[model samples]
Target: MKFFSKRELIILTLLFVLSFVPVVGGAIRILEIAGGPSVAPDNPRISNDPFPALLHLLGAIPFCILGAFQFMPSLRRYAPKWHRLNGRIVAFSGIVAAISGLWMTNYYALSIEIQGDLLYVVRMVLGTAMVLFIVRGVAAIRGRKISQHHASMTRAYAIGQGAATQTLMGLIWIALLREEPTGLMRDIMMTSAWVINLTLAEWIIRKTNNLSVSGSVS
Candidate 1:
């Protein structure tokens, strides 16, 4: 079980590391006074100034990377103060990411549905859930409910990592589907980004509790 936890952390680390490229790319675009291939030109998000894209990427970099380390047994055991400090950062960054995401969703024009059905409703629901989970997790910690905190944060982190998973799943969809998804199929494939990550996170939480079953999380 310990081995499994370690493996899971390693995987999360890889995903978090992989997230840097796009995050940095988006950041650079945000800096540009106006001269870069618009990742989503028509989508009011990138077109606007300080919006949905820039803020989300800014929040995502710290949130994804910092949250990834929280499960490291060594760090938790030897430097708990650091973990707590970093957790505070992660919590705030997570909220930022969620809010920015919702902002994008509210205004992101679904110009095309070929990639996947990333509908407005989907974004609203998921974004709201992410924020709530983070709040609940923080509350749990304040109340000394470490297990509950672990579960809630796990859910929040799982949702946040959707950014990374979507990239990977997008590749898989392109490779396997051979044909782009549209309509309901597109929606399911798009939403699968979060669903897949959350599924794994749930498994990790179960494995963690099984291994330690202690006040401190794995």
Candidate 2:
């Protein structure tokens, strides 16, 4: 049997494509930190305390890329061991990403024009939610609540992908406004990205659950 249906293939393709820019950006940041002195003005926060940024990048890259494969039902069914192992990696990576994100948000001395009060609160709440969702997913799987585990992990992955959506949102903001986002507008754009991802995640979760119910009934 095919490892992925046409729909699954499409989803995976989109996920990878969305991940490309963010992954590359993370890699560049890592390289900048490793190469030499802090030259990037916008990156001084990370340059001063690179450990959390490094942890976040290391965790987020794997979680965003490898976690995409976990959505493939055929792969999960046919290669349970790989699925389980990858799931563990994804889960651990997700926790690290979320925690490090929170750490940076709290400690990083970004300008109010860049981060703002609203953005700070939003980041804290969403970061906390991502960690909780991943923990709940692990617990659900351990308890053999497969559907709950899937839903929770899907939500966590969606939150983890906020950076990709934020990139898209930033581009759109620049296009529409003819200038880079700043202050409250930047906060809105960033928050909207997370909201959009979570909304789509919920829709997918509900659709998948409905399909599963219909299949089981038939």
lDDT of each: 0.77, 0.91
Q: State model 2's lDDT.
A: 0.91
* CA lDDT for candidate 1: 0.77
Q: Please, what are the lDDT tens digits per residue for candidate 2 over residues 137-210? A: 99999999988998999999999999999988898888888998989989998999999999999998998899
TM-scores of the candidates in the order shown: 0.81, 0.94
Deviating ranges (above 4 Å) for candidate 1: 1-9, 17-21, 33-44, 112-118, 177-183, 214-218
* Per-model RMSD to reference: 4.1, 2.1
Residue 28 of candidate 1: its Cα lDDT? 68
C-alpha lDDT (0 to 100) for residue 17 of candidate 2: 90
